[model samples]
Target: MSYADFARSIGLGGIAVDDPDKLGDAWGVALAADVPTVLDVRGDPEVPPIPPHATFDQIKSMTQAVLKGDPNAWHLLTEGIKTKARDILPSRR
Candidate 1:
């Protein structure tokens, strides 16, 4: 059984999967609940780790899409890279 179901089975309060904003609200609800509570959040399960030579735009896009708007992920992805793909990669056109 899921965390929510498990919590409810034992007479505790819980929150189940929902949209991003709803998931945040669920955390608030879980915190405020008097009894023990569970906040079961669901999200993208296959976010890849940042690459060794990832670029600014590459890291930015990946952070926005896969990391769910995490700014720190972008910073980490681009930390030591001095140049972007546009600076080093040859244009196909």
Candidate 2:
């Protein structure tokens, strides 16, 4: 219920997974406010690394990709941001 409430609070009405029993990721997103991480953790060391603090180009690339004309592009961009944000987020420990 709390997850649903939080998700709704963030303007995600249908994000409530098929089962209402699942946990909401809103808290995690909020928790990741200060973290930096790559979106795909496929153990592919070849993926370029992102610094603890992202550079202007990084931010710009993310924003451009997200705000790009295509919705699919936006999704990809947002996911990338989410990934980077995960690594830098305060581990919540």
RMSD of each: 13.8, 14.3
| Per-residue accuracy of model 1 over 44-68 as CA lDDT, tens digit each | 4433444667767886676567457
lDDT by residue (1-93, candidate 2, tens digit) is 445455456664423333212323533554464533222113222223456788888778856755666556655555665657666676554
Per-model C-alpha lDDT, please? Answer: 0.63, 0.49
Q: List pairs with backbone clashes in candidate 2.
A: 35-88, 35-89, 36-84, 36-88, 37-84
TM-score of each: 0.47, 0.33
Model 1 earns a TM-score of 0.47
* Candidate 1 residue spans exceeding 4 A from truth: 48-93
Worst 10 residues of 1 by lDDT: 77-86
